[model samples]
Target chain A: MTAWRLIDSGILRAAEHFALNRALLEARRQGGPSTLRFLRFAPSALLGYHQSAEQELRLDACTELGIDIQRRISGGGAIFMDETQFGWELYLDRADLGTRDMSIIARRICEAAARAVSGFGIDARFRPRNDIEVGGRKISGTGGVFDGDALLYQGTLLVEFDVEKMLRILRVPAEKLSGKAIADARDRVASLAELLGFAPPLDEVKARLEQAFGAEFGVTFQPGTPSEGELELYRAALPEIDSPAWINLVGKPRSDLPILEAAKKFPGGLLRAALAFDRPGERIRQAWFTGDMFVNPRRTIADLEAALKNAAGADVAGIVRDFFSTRDCDMLTLTPDDFIMVVHQAMAQAGPERTRP
Target chain B: MTSIGDCLFPDELFYNVDTGIWARREADGTITVGMTSCACSMVGELVAYLPKKVGEHVERNKSLATVESGKWVGPVKAPVGGEIIAVNGAVAAKAAIINADPYGRGWVAKMKPANWDGEAAGLITGAGVRAAFEAKMKADGLSRC
Candidate 1:
C-alpha cells in the first residue's frame, strides 16, 4: 500500500489554524494530496461557521483574556482551545470514503478515532451525531467541512482541561457559573491526564492515532510538509477567516436564544430543567438538568441533554417518553414523564405573550 | 409524484443529475433552484442554512447556498447561475423543510436564468428522470432512497 503523508503543524494562533483549514480544503478540492495533519492552538475561542459570537461567547471576556476569536469552516457549537488541547484532522476525497453521505462519513471517522482513544486502556466509544465518549462522558468532540468532493473532519482531545476557565468564557448565565456547576461539568467531560493519571508523551499519542486511522482505512502514514500550492491558498484565505467581518458574519442577538427554567418536585426527587429555547424555530436549542435525582450511570443526564438538543418544543413529551423506552437504565421512582413535565413547564415561559413587552 | 424508491423526481422539473439539484422555469421567466430528494436523504435533517444574499451574481457550478447537518457543512451548487433575486426565508429559519418538501416551499433561491434555452437543454427532465436517477442511485451505493 502507498504511504500517506502526515504533517504535524506546531502550535499556532486561531487565525492561522482556520486559514490553514480553508487553504487545505480548497487545495485538496483542486486535486492536491489527501493527508492527515495534527495541529495545536494558542488560547483561542472558535465559533461554528454559522454561529453568532454574541450568542455563544463572552466577547469582553475573550478580549480581556487575550484569546484570539475566529470562525471555523465547519459547523457545530463554539469551543475554547488552548495548548492543552490536541487537534487531528483527515483531508480526503469523498470517493475514497465509499459514500457521499456526510453523516456516514462523520460516523466512520469518529468510530476510527474512538478506537485510537481506546488504546489508552479506556473504554471509548463513538456517541451518536459526533462525540467520542468514555463511560458516557465526552473525551472528544468532532465536526467537518467539505468542498466539492474533498472533505475535512476534525476532532479535539483534551490533554488537561480547565472546566472553570472554560465556563467563565462561555455565555452561560452569570449566576449559573457557581463552583458547584463548574464541578458538575467535570462529570460530563473527561481528560487524558485525569483518566490515565499522567499526560502521555505527545509523540506516542500522535503515533497511536495515526496507526489506528491507518489500520481503519488501510493506508500507511509518512511524515511530510505542505506543498507550495497549499501555502498560496492559505495566504489568500487568511485575511478572510481572521477578519471581524468573517467572525461576525452570522450575527444574532443574545435574546434570540433565551434560557428558561422550571423546577418540580417528583416522587423520587426535585428535578429541574433549564433550557435555551429558539422561539422562532420552536425548538429547545439545549437542555440541562440538575437535581437530587437518583439516576445511576451519571452520564445519563448528559446523554439525555444531547438527545434533547434542537428537539421541537411540541414533541418534547414524546421524545422524552421515547428516549427512556429504549434505554436500559434505572431512574429510581422518577418516570421519564417527570422529565417531560419540567421541560414543558419551562418552554411555556417562551410563549409570545410572556416574552412580549 | 414520480419517485425512484422513496426519493422523488417530479416530471415537471429539470434536474442536474451530477449536481443533485433541480431547476424550475417559472412563468415570470425566473428559475427556481433547490436540492433534489436524493441530496436531502444524503445530508439527513439540516440544522442550519446560509444562502447567498439577494442580488448577488453567481457563476455556474458555484455555491448558491450552504447547509449543515450533524455538524457537516457543504455547498448546494448552482445549476445555471445568474443573479440571486430572492431566497427562502422559511428554509433559512427551519432547515427541516428541505427534507420534508424538497420540491415546493423548500426552494433555496430564485434567479433569472443566464441562458435558459441553452443550459436547460443539458439538464435531464420529463421521461428521462427515472433512468438518470436509477444510475445515480446505483453509483451512490444506495439500495433505498
Candidate 2:
C-alpha cells in the first residue's frame, strides 16, 4: 500500500492558511508527496475564491468581533469559522483519485469524510453536491481547487458551531437576526457538541478521518511535516496571498445582489420570506423564513431554505415541493403550497423577470 | 461536423481535446475560443463566469476564464499564448447560454495569438478531432454528452 504524509498545522491565521493552500497545491503539481493535513483557524470569515468580501461579509460586525477576513482558493459560498471547527485537506495528483470529473471526485472524498464523521456514532451521510449531514442537518461543508494535474480538496468539521454568530457575521437579510431566526438557523446546522452532548477530542476526530481516508484510497499515512521544497514555495507564496489584492480579487457591487422580500397572511399564520437574489445570475442566492408560522420541528423551514439556495428562478416551486414530499412535517393550517407561494412572491418583488435582458 | 456520442465537433475548428476547448481562426487573423459541447455537458448549468480581462496576456495552458456549476469551479485554459482582445459579453451576462448554444453566441473570448505558427501544431483538427475527443471522453469516464 502507498504511504501518504500527514501534517498537523495547528492553529493559524486565515492569511497563512490561504497562503499554505497556494504553496501546497503548487508543491503537489511539481510532484510533491501526497499529504493529509489537519488545520484549525482563529476567528475568521472566509470568502469563496471568486467572491467579494464586501458583498459576502459584514465588515463592521467582523471588525468588532476581531475576526480576520480572508478568501479561500476553493470555490463555494462564504463561511464564518473559528477555533470550534477543525479543517481537513488532501493534496494529491488528479490521478490519485482515479477521476478527472469534478463531481465524481467530490463524491468519493465526501463519502469517505461522511464515514469518518459517522464513526462518532452520529448517522452522517453524504448529501449530493457537497455536504455531510446528520438527520437532514448539515455537519460539514466542503470545496476544492485544482492547478494543472494537482488538486486540493478540503472540508470543515463543526466541533462546536455557533449558528447565530455565523448568521450575524454574514451579510444575510436583516430579518435573519431575530430570535426566532436564530432558532431556525440552529435547526439547519449540526455540531459535534450539539449532537454528542460534548465535543469529541480533536485527536479522536483526526484519527477517525485518517483511518477512513486511508481505507478509501488504499494508502497508509505516515506522520510528516512540510518538505524543504514546499517550505521554499510557501516563503515565495506568502507575499502574494497575504495581501489585500488577493483578498479583493473579485469584488462586485452589493447593489447587484439585493435582499428582496415578501410577506402574506395565510390561514395558518403570517408567512414571509427574505431572498438574497443575484440579479445577473438570475438565481435565488439564499432564502430565509420569518413570521408567526407554527410548524412541527421548526428546523423544516431552515432545511427548506438550504434546499432553495442557488435555485434557478423557474425551478423554485418544483424544488420546494420535492423538499416537502420527501420529509414529514406538521404545519398547522398551512400547506406546502403556501410556502412555495410566499417564496415566489418574494422572488417576484425582485422584478418581472429574473433573467438578464 | 463530426459527432462523438451526442457532442458535435465542427471539422473546421481547432481543438485541444485534453483541455476541452476549441478555437476558430477568424477571417480577421484573430482566434475565437469557447468550451466544447462535451465540456458543457460534463459541467451542468453554469451559474457564474469570470473571464480574464481584455488586453491581458495569457500563456498556453493557463486559465483564460473560470466558470462555476453545482458549486464546483473549474478553469477554461487557453490553447495558445495570446493577448485577449475581446470577451463575449452576452455569455458573461447569462452563462447558461454557454450550455444552450456553446458554439454560437456562447463563444468565450477572442485573442490575437502571439505565435500562431508555433502553437498551431499543438491543437488537433480535421479528421483527427473526433477520435481525439472520443479517447479523452473514455479516459475521463464520461458516458455521453
Candidate 3:
C-alpha cells in the first residue's frame, strides 16, 4: 500500500496558513510526496482568490471584531472562520486522484470527507459543487487550487459554528440578520455540536478523516511533519502571502455586486427574494428566499439558491423549472412561477428595467 | 473550422493541446491568444478573469490569464514565450464573454512573440489539430464537448 505523510498544525494565523497553502502546493508540484494536513485558524475572514474583499466582506464589522482578513489560494466565496472550525487539506499530484476533471476530484474527496463526518452517527453526504451536508444543512464547505501537476484541496468542518457572527462578518443583505433570518440561517448550516448535542474531541475527528481518506485512496497515512524544504519554501512565501497586496489582489467596484430585493403577496402567503447579482458577469452570485411562503421541506429554498448560484440570466427560468420539477416540494397555492417572478423582479431592480416572462 | 465533436478548432490557428489554448498569428508580428471551445465547456461560465498586465513577459506554459468559474480558478497558459501587448477589455468587463464567444471578442490577450518561429514548430495546427485534441480528451477522460 502506498504510504502518505500526515501533518497536524495545531493553530496558525491566517497569513501563516495561507503561506503554507502556497508552499505545500508548490512543493507537491515539484514532486514532493502526497500529504494530508489538519489545520486550525485564529478568527479570520477569508476571501477566495478571485474575490474582492471589499465586495464580499464587512470590513468595519471585521475590524471591530478583531478578525484578520486574508485571501485563500483556492477558489470559492468568502467565508468567516475561526478556532471553532478546523480545516483539512490534501496536496497531491493530479495522477494521485486518478482524474483531471475538477468535479470528479471534488466528489471523490467530498464523499470521503462525508463518510468521516457520518462516523459521528449523523448522516452526511457530499452535496453538488463542493459541500458536505447533513439532511440538506451544510456542515462543511470545500474548495481547491491547482498549480502545474499538483493541487491543494481543502475543506472546513464546523465543529461549533457561529451563524450570527458569520452573518455579521459577511456583507449579506442587511435584512438577513433579523431573528427570522438567523433562524433560517441556522436551519441551513449544521454543526457537530448541534447535530450530535456536543462537539467531538478534535483528535477523534482527525482520526476519522484519516481513516476515511486512507480507505478511499488505498494508502496508509504515516504521521509526519513538514519537510525542511517545505519549511524553507513557507518562509519564502510568507513575505508575499502575508502582505496587504495579496489580500487586496482583486479589486472591483461595489456597484458591480448589488443586493436587490423584491416581495409579492401570493394566495398562500407573501414571498420574498433577495439576489446578489453580478452585473458584469450577468449572473446570479447568490439568492435568499424568505417570507410567509409555505413549503413542506424547509431546505427547498436553500437547494433552489444553490441551483441558481452562478446561473446565467437566460438560463434562470430553465434552471428554476428543472429544480422544482426534479424535487417534490409541496407549496400550497404557491407555484414555482411565483418564485421565479420574485427573483426576476429582484434582479430587474439592479439596472435599466428588463423584463422576463 | 475543424472540429472534434462540438468543439471548434480553427484550422488557421496553432494550438497547445496540453493547455487547451490557441494562438492566432496576426498580420502584424503580434499573436492573439484565447481558450478553445473545449476549455470553455470544461469550466462552465466564467465569472472572473485576471490577465497579466500588458508589457509583462510570460514564459511558454506559464499563465497568461487567470479565470474563475463555478468557484474553480485556473490559469490560461501562454503557448509561447512573449510579452503581453494587450488584453481584451470586453472579457475584463464581462467574463462570461469568454464562454459565449471564446474565439472572437472573447480572446484573452495579444502578445508580441519573442520566438514564434522556434515555438510555433511545437504547436499543432491544420489537419493535426483534431487528432491531437482527441487524444488529449481521451487521456483526460473527457467526453465530447
Candidate 4:
C-alpha cells in the first residue's frame, strides 16, 4: 500500500554495482528501505557466489575483451554483462508480502517483470525458475538473495546485440559454437536491436520496468538515493569483492563436472550437444547443442536448456516431456525423446558409467 | 498415510511437522532425516548444498545443513537432537536430487539419536502426519502439491 523507493544507478563498474547489492540488501533487512533499482554493468563477467571462475569462464578471452570478471552474491550460473544489457533489481521486506513461499515470490516478481518487458511490443513471458523470454528466446535472466526479512531480485535485459562477445567470455560449449555453430546462437537470443532495429534509451526502458512493477505491487515509486548506512556497508564490502579469493570462492575440480558430448544422425538432421553435468546431483548444470536440427521457432533448444536448469536426475525424462508437450515445435521426424536420449548417453560417460539394465 | 493440502504424507515416517522434516528410525537405533516435499517446493530449485560433518552433534531445530535455491540460501534445521552418523555426500554434490526424489536417495543425513524414545513420542506418524501437514499447508495458504 505504501510507495516504494526507486534508485537508478546508470552504468556502474561491476564492483560498485555489486557493492550496492550488498549495501541495499543489508539496509532492507535492517528495515532501511523498500525500493526498486535499475542498474547497468560496465562490461563485466559476473559469476554466481558459489561458482568458480576457473571452471565457468575462459579467463584468457575475458582478459582480451577487457571484461571485469566478478562474482555476484546471489546463486546461479555465470553471465556476461556489459552496457548492451540493462539490470533491474528490487529490495523488499518479507512481512510486507502475504506469502512466505520462495517460489511463489519468484513467480510473482518474474511475472511482473515479464509484463514490463512485454510493454516493449514483444510477447515477453516469465518461464519458470527465472528467465524472461520472447517466443522461447531468452531476453532476460534473473536471480536473487534474502537476508532476514529483506529480499533482493535482480535481472539482465539484452537491449542490443553481441553473440560473439558472450561466446568468447563464457567457456560456453566452445566446440559447438565454432563456425556455423556461432550462427545458431542468433536464433537463441534476441535483442532490442534485432527486434526493433535500434537500442531503446535507458531511461525509457527503466520507466517501463518501474511502471510494470509498480502496477503489479499497487505501489508508486518515489525517487531516492542510498542511505548513509548503505554507503558504509558499500565501503566495507568493496575490498572483499575486489579480491581474487572472492572471484574464485567456490573452486571445485573441473573433473567433478565433466563436459560430455553426444550426437545422433536423426531423420531430420544431425543433432549434437556438449553437456556439463553435476554427476552427483544428476542434474545438467549447463547444456549446448549444435548441428542440423530443424525446429521451427528456432529458440527451442535454449528454451529447453532454461527449462531443464536445476532439474532432478530422475526428472529429466519428465522435464523433456513436459517441455515438448506444452508447445508445438516442428522437430520434423525427430522427437523430444531423441534429445533426452542423446543427453543421457553423454551424461552416462562422465559419471560412474551406468550400464543399461 | 496423511494428506495435507493434497500432498501425500506417508504415516510410517516420523515427522517434526513444526520444522517440515521427517525422520525414520533404523533397526540399529540410528535415524535418517530429510526435508519434506512441501519444504522443497517452497524453496524452489536448489543450486548448492552444504551439510555438517558426520559425527557432529546437532541440537533439535538447529541447522544441520545449508542450501541455496533461486539465489536465496538458508539452513535446513535438524528435526530431532542427535549426532550425525553419516551425510549424503552424493546429494551434497548435486542438490537438485533432494527435490527429485526427496523421500528416497535424497535423504540428507543419518543420525544416532541422543534420545530416540523421548523425541520419537512427540513426532507425528502415518495418519497424524497427514493432519499436521494439512494444517500447516492451510495456514501457509498452499494448495495441493
lDDT for each candidate structure: 0.85, 0.86, 0.88, 0.80
Q: Which stretches of candidate 4 lie over 4 Å from their true place?
A: A351-357, B1-38, B51-66, B70-72, B75-88, B100-145
Question: Considering summed lDDT, which 10 consecutive residues are worst modelled in model 3 chain B?
Answer: B136-145
| Residue pairs whose backbone atoms clash in candidate 1 | none
lDDT of 2 at B145: 39
**Higher-ranked by lDDT: 1 or 4:** 1
Q: Alpha-carbon error at A196 in model 1, in Å?
A: 1.2
lDDT of 4 by residue, A272-314 (tens): 8777776655667777777778888777888888877766556
Clashes of each: 0, 0, 0, 3
Candidate 2 docking class: medium
Scoring only the A-chain of each prediction against the true A-chain gives TM-scores of: 0.96, 0.92, 0.96, 0.94
TM-score of every candidate relative to the true structure: 0.96, 0.93, 0.95, 0.81
- Give residue A27's lDDT in candidate 1 (0 to 100): 81
* Top-down DockQ ranking: 1, 2, 3, 4
Off by over 4 Å in 3: A174-176, A353-357, B135-145
10 residues in a row with least lDDT, candidate 2 chain A: A348-357
Tens-digit lDDT string for candidate 2 (B42-139): 66677778899999999998999988776667788998999999998877767888988888888889999999889989999999997787777677
- State residue A254's C-alpha deviation in candidate 3, in Å: 1.5
lDDT at A26, model 2: 87
